[model samples]
Target: MTSRTFAAFLQRSLEELKEQGLYNTIEPLEGPNGPTIAIRGRELVNLSSNNYLGLATDERLVEAAVRAARTWGAGSGAVRTINGTLRLHEELEEKLAAFKGTEAAVSFPSGFACNMAAISAVMGPGDAILSDELNHASIIDGIRLTKSTTIRYRHSDMDDLRAKAREARDSGKYEKIMVVTDGVFSMDGDVAKLPDIVDIADAHDLIVYVDDAHGSGVLGGGAGTAKHFGLSDKIDLQIGTLSKAVGVVGGYVAGSRELVDWLKARSRPFLFSTALPPAAVGASIAAIELLQESRELQERLWRNAAYLQQGLRELGFSVGATETPITPCMIGNEETTQLFSRRLYEEGVYAKAIVFPTVPRGTGRVRNMPSAAHTTELLDAALAAYAKVGRELRLIP
Candidate 1:
């Protein structure tokens, strides 16, 4: 039998969340997660995926995955430190390093795992981390794992970062100091002030770590935020995810050869967890090659993004400070935001409402991710839905 105390605590916590409209209801997709998705047997314009380049459903990637599975079997069969380091894995890493303009790279099972492994591997009790306040949850958790003294500067506020960095450096209390941030703030879609950040890091002699999970495949002709800012050599560590724009599963850290070697030696996830599957590795390699060969997909992605963002703005919906494809129609009240999302779904759009603690309270929104796969017609349909719902709810005049 279960413990009554534990069950009671779970019940109370769930009840409180539901009461506050903070509880999220999961809806399973009936088919492939493409530009359009089917939920509850209804087709809707999909605006909740991170498949920025539509490569997740690309034929070239699918064929590559099939070939890989045929040749390498299903799984890697062990942790990377063991016999799991397949030739295919090495090829993927090589392509990633080349694409990111780095000397070498190390792969992890997921982006979250990459941060967890990399951060804790290099930082410890005597070390300090200066982090952006609005950094992703994975970054926040990774810092916590290190037991390092974490100093949160204002989000993208270089003055605050410089002040904190100088104080941390002058304090002489920590052994190694590192500054970490997201290349693209996923929630707000604003690119990081990387050029300024590199300048500050240069002044303080701090190790610079950037998790360009969203920025990769979308920025710098698909080279990522560091390359977008022409600071690939200046930034110390760069992290990326294959699942987002690459349309596959896994994460990687690219930097100097020494950093890659160090992560391979010390990262716990690499040492403990089983390796990514052959199919995923194969598909990711194809995706990277595709990105390297042409800028057609990136161009399409940006065009669709601009078109949708402009449509929302013309409809008078506030898409807060986004400089990228992630468009959020800001709706302040939690319940109202949820209702708006539901209304959109009813009108055949599948954008989801993001509330705390994904974002701050009273800053709830219906976050829309426009992909290259979405045609102009699909986007227009989504905008029409937005118009009807916004007017019905009196959200727009």
Candidate 2:
């Protein structure tokens, strides 16, 4: 018999998830996460990675990382509050501010930690946050960390936000009020109505926060979602990741100099967590510079997305409303969604199925992320595999 410990609860919980068909099996890629990846010796069209600009394996980024690693060592020696603050990190932050069009920026080890550090640093028990219903898990967790009251508005519903904001402000039960949202919903790929959101925030005198983890390097001509909507100057905080489109690993909060300075003094992550490796910082700087210099990569990403979207629609598969490179082929049943993903893998496409909890129940889908590196032939191959699997499962006629 197994020994009594926390293992029982954990084991039972995992078992329940598997029984409910919610347990996911992770597939380890044999090589870099590029437009094409090898799994068990088979090369497949990789539509599962967040490397939107294909910089993860870019030669320039690789060279920059190698140079930094050679020059700065493999890891940061300490946390930012200590001696871990390196020159490369400072330069990266500078470029980050420029790219996001902010007065200053502060970097974190990851996007999740950035949210945790930034959100909790600003608000507390007496304050309230008006968050979007569809914000990322990181934001939700961050809100939970603070002793603040959270009021969730309907996703992209400006009227709902207005109502919530007014209620929070008039109740006089809170000292500060802020609104937070994902600039682009990762699941459905729909953009947030930032102009309307900004308008509501202005009218209610609420601080505005945007987590543009999926929008940077994909929108605003590669600046970000706030810039895409021409409201960068109006947003109180603009959070973004260096991992997804930048093809590196880090996160940042871009805002006014005073806000950044406050975070530098108050954020727990920056105070306690180790700084990002010099390689990541260097590569991110290079990636942002590249993005600023050219729109070619962004154009390629959009073209690839359009091609796949059109192909899926023509094949009778229901591709959900996506305004970006993320394509969600909806399959309402959970088990079938998992099976569809597996069949697609067998046919040489590597899109993953997202089900309950990640998305609402009865809205399972295979979330495909097309990248700039995908050749036309590779995309065509992916379309063919999707058609084969979708038809085999009777998901499409």
Model 2: per-residue Cα lDDT over 106-133, one tens digit each: 9999999999999999999999999999
| Per-residue error (Å), model 1, residue 397 | 0.5
Candidate 1 segments exceeding 4 Å error: none
Provide the overall lDDT of each model, using Cα atoms, as 2-decimal numbers.
0.95, 0.93
In model 1, state the lDDT of residue 95.
Answer: 93
How well does candidate 1 score on lDDT at residue 207?
Answer: 98
lDDT of 1 by residue, 1-397 (tens): 4799999999999999999999999988898889999888899999999999999999999999999999998999999998999999999999999999999998999999999999999999999999999999999999999999999999999999999999999999999999999999999999999999999999999999999999999999999999999999998899999999999999999999999999999999999999999999999999999999999999999999999999999999999999999999999999999999999999999999999999999999999999989999999999999999999999998
Question: What's the lDDT for residue 189 in model 1?
Answer: 93
Q: Number of backbone collisions per candidate, in order?
A: 0, 0
Candidate 2 runs further than 4 Å off: 1-5
Model 1 clash pairs? Answer: none
